[model samples]
Target: MSGHQMPATESVWDYPRPPALLRETRRITVECGGDVVADTTKALKILETSHPPVFYVPPDDVRTDLLRAAPRRSWCEWKGSAEYWDVVVGTDIRPLAAWSYPAPRPPYELLIGHVAFYAGRVDRCTVGGCTVLPQEGDFYGGWITPEVKGPFKGGGHTHGW
Candidate 1:
């Protein structure tokens, strides 16, 4: 986690606690079952210690008609409760593939009703035309692009981190 190790990289360890938001203009596109579920150049990235960035696209860019409310819900200490969504495209259905904080807590009010898709669950997720790699762990929804560096914390032996 030493910054000296990789001069050109931003260590996740150096990222702030409670997370931070970075607005990006890179083209972000999500596809599922041959259909474009989301496409936008305006996206907000969530950065936190031990994790890659999680991009949240505005609802206007997402195909809401393809998303159905899921039964599951989860809570975050900083962001508040999250509601899941099942994406349906053509005959394909990916349940709990996306999530949103319809009513986020303070400091995260920007994320309200904004949608974030799990790269691992979707057919493909791209950033600036480069397909993104999903964070190693099953639970985290971080997207790993070449511009991001890791020793990321979502994989094995990261529980205590």
Candidate 2:
């Protein structure tokens, strides 16, 4: 798939291959099951080629009491193994709604204490003051904001990308 950068917008194609982990001060928030699960102005974003940025919030900023350890785990070539967390609010439970790399590979080790959520799995997620859109598939947890343009890689048939 092809994509073009627009004025005032960033093209996912312009992002790096190994992915750049950058800190952001914009307000990022996540809500689910009628409760605010996470809220933070200090966040880390993972910008990779052909995908929107994935915002990772520090564990201290999240409501840890509301998160339960999940049984699911996954491996990433760049970040190493990841552990999942389920968001629990009263009787509502979102299974494996968030993930983090407890022991990431080099360059990604900075992500140690941060957690990234799946926008589609959560009730809502916002960057700055704008709501976010989940990257086009279930596999990738990229958050699509207005300033990021995409012909993103998460959709069907993009596995070979």
Candidate 3:
């Protein structure tokens, strides 16, 4: 746990902060088929890591129609505004991959809209049960769910991490 070291202009929190799952956290879950979208009971955060802990839900629970809004954008001056996602798994495509921030920036503003996923473009990246392995540079696939246990860094196949 050590990655929120922001200090180029100084800005980390002013409000909206409540997520750090670790007390079982309802065993965690993020489904896309049987709905259930993302469940953790309440807020869940673990922002201090080498990478593998980002469960900031609260965008209406997130089922957002299998996510389909990827005009492509990236920027994180310490968690502010960022949008992405193209995970339409019923047919199979995997675009933008997944990203979320909505309007963060008040110490993260509770992740504004909340939404993070890259476990390699999402398709089947479980954790605790073991089933990661991909992250290297291809659009990220790290930090899935279950209990965090596997390999997910960027994905594999060669594209444009």
- What digit string (tens of lDDT, one per residue) describes model 3 on residues 85-127? 7867577657876688777665656566667666555544343
After best superposition, candidate 2 residue 118: deviation in angstroms?
0.3
Instruction: Report the number of the highest-TM-score candidate.
Output: 2
Candidate 1 regions with alpha-carbon error over 4 angstroms: 1-8
**TM-score between candidate 1 and the true structure:** 0.91
Please give the lDDT score at residue 33 for candidate 2. 95
lDDT of each: 0.90, 0.92, 0.54
lDDT winner between 1 and 2, please give it: 2
Task: Encode model 2's per-residue lDDT on 59-117: one tens digit a residue.
Answer: 89999898899999999889999999999999999998999999999998889989999
- Evaluated against the true structure, the overall lDDT of model 2 is 0.92
Q: What is candidate 1's lDDT per residue for 1-161, written digit by digit as tens?
A: 75544225577778899899889798999999999999999889899988989999999999999999999999988898999999998789999999999999988899876899999999999988889999998778999887678789877788887
